[model samples]
Target: MTRTPQCPGCGREDRLQAVPAVYLGGRDTVRVRVRNPDDHHDRTVDRPVTTALSEALAPVPEPPSRAIGCLGVLALLVAVGTFAAGAGAGHWLDDVPVVEGGGVFDENGIFHAPGQELPTAGPAWPDFAWLAVISALALTAAVLVLVLRIRSRRAFTRLTSGRAQAERLWSRAWYCHRCGTVHFRDAPGEDTRPLTFQEFRERVWQEGGYGDLAATQRALGGVLSIRPGQ
Candidate 1:
């Protein structure tokens, strides 16, 4: 026979329920009436207790790989634009004839050439070549950013592998409605002071190895620490 769960705070077995069960039981549904049957809707409402439990048990969000990837993509677009501009300028410059002094005069009468002796006021072939080189460097940087993003995503996946075990631990937690405290079923009898929701959740996650994972992520730095709200 299964023994009834007793609340550590009130020493009563009558009002104790599993945390997950309490959360589920505290939810209410409201049906909205509409003229059309297809437009009818049912909305789930969570009681205050249920909302608190849900927030406490919510999963840690993944690292901001998507935002980093967007930066990589923006860099790639800039590289492409610069490359196209450089190539177009080079092609246009190739058609222009060099004057007798190895320099060409622009419509504004500014002279440009490959050497230091000539005036460098107008666009020239060498300028476009340097632009192409800069574009190539930018492209390389963008590629590196994208690769790092992929690696960070993979690392986050590996780090969160123990989340299921943490959730299992959470499922076994008990809530005392009378005193508003939570505790695990196997909690020590001597340490019967019930934990707050946050404390309970943290203990569960720590026992499930998620605490180390969080620490490791923090050590890794960069986008790993980029969680929402902080």
Candidate 2:
């Protein structure tokens, strides 16, 4: 039997126990300890606790994680396809202005419609039209993909580490070692730039509405290092 310490949180004696059951550490970290001031043998662990217990404590899940793979893949593919199409359209096709309506051209050089302007078949129409469509679709897809990848990576890190208040925000975000925030195996744009602690604290204070004055100041000092001069 391992001798446990009482929770400083609830002042219950004996390893993870409290005179009265209370939440502590992770979920199971604050286990159920029956306190019998009269008895020396009483204790219990109620639930099957795991690491996720601590992760749930984060203020927000943060970015990118809320998104993931397949969608990112599809967007990348579209961007490639659209860019190819745009290139083909812009460079290969010859613009032959035929007409500008949806009337049926009966194979002959004659147009058949009361007042509808005929859509003239241009030489480069096939190449240019397809290219343009592809390019537009592809670019949009690519942008979406890039954004999602960035976000998912960030989220995954947050999920794993449920970072503490004192930890350098920039340190965590840049070296998100757990989720591999910076390491890219020969992938494009793998170079990660981490914000300094000061920058991080400033950004958080200004952007995120964390209204804790002590926390805000601590973040600025710890993360940003606001030593009097530099």
Candidate 3:
């Protein structure tokens, strides 16, 4: 009941396979990966989900959140200020005595006023050092938060092109050549369909969005590696 195609390279039906891949996020393109078990040749091709394909195809874009970025920067500044204040306190404490009762000082070391009792000795080191350590930890956490916030903002604000969107919509697939040129099939038992690179240059110019295919390609390229291939 099912008809299968043979591999063009080896003329064998068992050596060819077609796999179908789909992306459900935004785009509606199907990608077919064609493979030949004999020679190990592999190729991936994209096709529109619908018969009428647009030149400028893209997914919905998410808006940027400036508020989050501002908040992150504010947090970072506050952390730095806290650390600086702690450091200043430590420096100021350096001049004060750390004896049991906290002694007083004059130009020549310990001061003994006329009939004044000397203060009790205090701890050897000032407690300001603890403040500095805590502040340093807070600053480190703030820096980490700031970095994450900036990365998230860039992700939301970055532009995605039509071509890249189209690629996202493509389905994963496999294929093998039959007699003439290469043909694609969803599975070994399914009927074969002709697969070829669909150029959107003329259609892009006529439809609306991009002026040419090159423009579409450029627009699809992203500044970050996380986005789809351009």
Candidate 4:
């Protein structure tokens, strides 16, 4: 059994494979490749050299789920619309009269006799208009609640999937052998400007954040060296 050492990059003890040497500028360098298929973490690091070739420790970034967010908003709006329409229909139906048993029932289903307190009341009957309105509103509200819950859950699932994919792709760090500078592929702190290896070296050592290339290399394990001049 060939025992591969723990990965220096992500620290996975298993499933580490030694990849073919990559010759850049005629320098043959060995790399160990390790990947977590579940999280989509795929990266290759130098065999044993230190000096932090890349910012591998930084957390992976997630992607924006604009479409999922929009769908959730749309579902909420539809639920509100359904509730409003049910209420409006009920209000309209409440003003109409009904005829039954050779007698006319008013909106409240009460028969009023004249010359008795101006409005007389007899044995009260059930009111069907308000009942119909209430029933419609209640049924519509229930269905709206169910639909909103389902759609919201679906949207959340999709958003989480998108974030996972983004993290996998952007989290791994990259090393520029020519410039000897290490930077994260998609880290938020990355610079947007186009810079050569020399420019990157100058910015890191002389500008700010991290200064003194020699000191940095010594501190990080002394795997890289600055060019002869600047």
Off by over 4 Å in 4: 1-125, 170-230
Q: What TM-score fits each model?
A: 0.52, 0.30, 0.29, 0.23
What tens digits encode model 3's per-residue C-alpha lDDT throughout 1-230? 87555554445675344322111222467899888788899978887562211212222222455676666567667767766776675553444433344445644587654445544455333666666666667667677777877787665444323434333322222333232222433433423443322222223222332333333343222112122111
Kindly list the per-residue Cα lDDT of model 4 for residues 18-45, writing each as its tens digit: 1111112223357988896788898888
Instruction: Give the TM-score comparing model 3 with the true structure, all chains together.
Output: 0.29
Alpha-carbon local distance difference test for all models: 0.63, 0.41, 0.43, 0.40
Assess candidate 2 and give its TM-score to the true structure. 0.30
Model 1, 52-141: lDDT tens per residue? 344444434335547778888888988999888987877634444434566676677777774534433555667678778778888998
Query: Predictions ranked by lDDT, top down?
Result: 1, 3, 2, 4
Clashes of 1: 0
Better of 3 and 4 by lDDT: 3
- Which is the better candidate, 1 or 3, if ranked by TM-score? 1
Native-referenced Cα lDDT, model 1: 0.63
Off by over 4 Å in 2: 1-5, 8-11, 17-50, 57-63, 66-72, 82-131, 144-230
Q: Measure candidate 1: CA RMSD.
A: 11.7
Model 1: CA > 4 A from native:
1-55, 59-61, 92-124, 174-181, 186-193, 213-230
